[model samples]
Target: MRTLVVVRHSKAEQSGTPDFERHLAERGHGDAADAGRWLATQGIGPDAALVSSSVRTVETWTDIAEAAGWDLEADFDRGLYSAGPETALDLVRLTPPETTTLVVVGHNPTMASLAQMLDDGEGDPEVAGRMNEDGFPTSAVAVFAFDGEWADLDMGTATLVAFHVGRG
Candidate 1:
């Protein structure tokens, strides 16, 4: 079975400037590390990661990537920094089928919506609860299981296997 790990970027600093260059805050660092450790325990480590180019998202992935010891080279995609759920889905499809697992570090609404959009099947009750309980916080990770190829993955086609979301 192939797995998809949809991770929302960790919390970022809110600067006075109106630009999209805000970096992660101190709390964001801790949260991401905790979240990464949590992913390893859940066996959600990815062979590769498709991360956003956003300063916050990039920084978020750095901590989690290190904590998980994934030892993978990440693809920083500008499209993902501000893409919608559909866009994210398309990106996942681009992954090679040989890749057993993948991690996508991106923004909210898209990540959360993607999880909610996927079809359910024998999912962990607690996992689903966490995905919705906190609105997909920064550094949150949503685990999904699929029996087929990524190209065939669709909303409601997979189950919400597990969710390692943030507390804040």
Candidate 2:
């Protein structure tokens, strides 16, 4: 089975920061670290990650990697900077079938929407319900499980296995 983890970029300074250069806040840092630990405990160490090229997204992935004790090299894509759910989905499809696990660290509402769109509502009902109701908050993690290769992945073909909101 293949697994996908979608993570929204953490909170960032709202003012005086450019859209592309915004850095995470102190709370964001702590929340990201906690999320990383959560991923480790959940046994979701991704083999590879596709991250946005924005400062905040890269920082978030770095913190997650450090906290999880993972040695992953992220593919920072400029197309993911302000991409939509469809764009993100296309990227997922491009992943090599040999990659059993993948993670995408990006911004919302694209990341959040992609998580919801990919979920077939066939895994944990509670997690799916929470995701539908609360939406994908910053630093949130959405875990999906798929039975086929990445090339065969499509909308509503994967199951939502877990959802986690980073807490500072």
Candidate 3:
């Protein structure tokens, strides 16, 4: 089976910084690190990660990487900067076949939309209900499982196996 993890960038403070340069807030760092630790406990580790090049996204990944002790390098893509759900799915579909676990770190509502759209509503009713109500909050991780290669991933093909939202 293949696993896909989609993570929305952690909380970012809006100041004089531009959208692309905005760094993660203190809460974001804590939340992201907690998420990493949680993933580690669940024995979930990504073989590869596709991350947005934006500052907040990069910072969030760095925190997660440190806490998870993952040495893999991330493929930071410019196309993921502000892309929508379709673009996010396309990027996931293009992942190499050898990577059994792939993680994507980017912004929302694209991340949330992709999670909600790809979910067949057959995994966890509680998670799905919470997602429907609150949407994908920052630092939320949505995990999907499938029985095929990355190239064949289709809408609603993967089953949502787990979902988590980290908080400071």
Candidate 4:
């Protein structure tokens, strides 16, 4: 089975900086680190990662990887910065078939929509409910299990296995 971990970037500064250049806030760092630790405890070691090129998303991924003790490199894509759910899925579909576990760190609305769109309602119902009710806040993560090749993945084809909201 293949695993997909979708993450929304942690809280970011709301200063006058450009959106793409905005950095993470103090809370964002701690929350992202906690998220990494949580993923580690869940035994999720991603073989590949796709992160948005925005500063906040890159920082979030860096913090997560550091806390998880992972040494994998991530593909930072500019397209991911403003990609919608379908566009993000297209990017995911491009992943190499050999990768069994993939992590995607990106902006919200898109990330949240992707998680909801991918759910097949065949896994943990309570987790799915919570994910729907709580909305995709900062540092939110949704894990899905897919039994097909990455290229063949489509809407509602994966099962939501877990959901988490990272806090420090």
Candidate 5:
């Protein structure tokens, strides 16, 4: 009955600078904030937040936290900066079972792929409906429910609850 929310970091600005250091554009800040607000409407206050250490990811989470007003404390991990979906899954699996809800704010194609990869509800209409909604845009949040404890979550074991692609 626990929830896992995966938030693909907000749209970021491209610069001549290296990828890890790029900052969020002005529009991205607002987009990230919009996502946070939307998540609030959906009742998404994560008990724990696992975030990437990249600058853009950090900035996006900051704006999201401000908008959500959850004042949540997050654990920033450098491994998440360039980690793949499997790596991310490992982090989630290791989360303390006491955490009822969790959020992972990071990058994608891994995010999108992970959603599809971990979807468990094959014939359920709502799961398919949510999957059909839209791409995981900047600040997009995907919510899913796992059949087992977080410690035992596996590929294709999650059922999509809601897919939010926020617009600013």
Candidate 6:
């Protein structure tokens, strides 16, 4: 089985700075760390990560990796910065086949849409309901379980095993 974790970048400053360069806000750091800690508790250690090239997203992954005590490195993809659900999925599909656990950190509604689109409606009904109702927020993480290789993953091919909104 393969595990996929989708994450929306943490809160970022709303300054005049370019969107790509916008840094994470104070709360974002703590919240991302909390997310990492939570993933650790769940024993979700990712072997690969694909993150947006945006500054905020990179910082978000950095904090998450540090807090989770993971020495993993992430692939910073510029395409992910503005990728929609399908595009994001294409990026994830590029993941190496040997990677059993992978994480993708990007912006929403891509992250949120990707999570919802991938759900096969065969896992936790309550969690899926909550995710649909609450919407994906900053520091949100969606965990999925797939029975095939990364390249073969497609819409409705995975089960939404868990949903979490990290807050600190």
Q: Could you say which candidate leads in TM-score? A: 4
lDDT rank order: 4, 6, 2, 3, 5, 1
Q: Residue 85: error of model 5 in Å?
A: 0.9
> lDDT score of model 5?
0.84
Error of 3 at 2 (Å): 0.4
**Of the candidates numbered 2 and 3, which has the greater TM-score value?**
2
| Overall lDDT per candidate, in order of appearance | 0.83, 0.91, 0.89, 0.97, 0.84, 0.95
For each of the candidates, the C-alpha root-mean-square deviation to the true structure, in angstroms, is 1.6, 0.8, 1.0, 0.5, 1.7, 0.6
lDDT of 2: 0.91
Model 4, range 87-159, lDDT digits (tens) per residue?
A: 9999999999999999999998999999999999998889999998999999999999999999999999999
Superior candidate under lDDT, 2 versus 5:
2
Worst 10 residues of 4 by lDDT: 116-125
Tens digits of lDDT, candidate 6, 104-159: 99999899999989999999899899889879999999999999989999999999
**Lowest lDDT 10-residue stretch of candidate 2:** 10-19
Model 3 spans > 4 angstroms off: none
lDDT of 2 by residue, 1-168 (tens): 999999999988787868999999999999999899999999987888999999999999999999999998999999998789998999988998778899999999899889978999789788988888889999999999999988778899999998999886
lDDT of 1 by residue, 1-168 (tens): 988888888777788854358888898988998888888888776887999888888888888978877787899998997789988999998999898898888887888888788847468777677677867877778888888998988878888887776543
Q: After superposition, how far is residue 164 of candidate 4 from its true place, in Å?
A: 0.5
Residue runs of model 1 more than 4 Å from their true location after superposition:
none
Arrange candidates, best TM-score first. 4, 6, 2, 3, 1, 5
lDDT score, candidate 4, position 28: 98
Q: In candidate 6, list every pair of residues with a backbone clash.
A: none
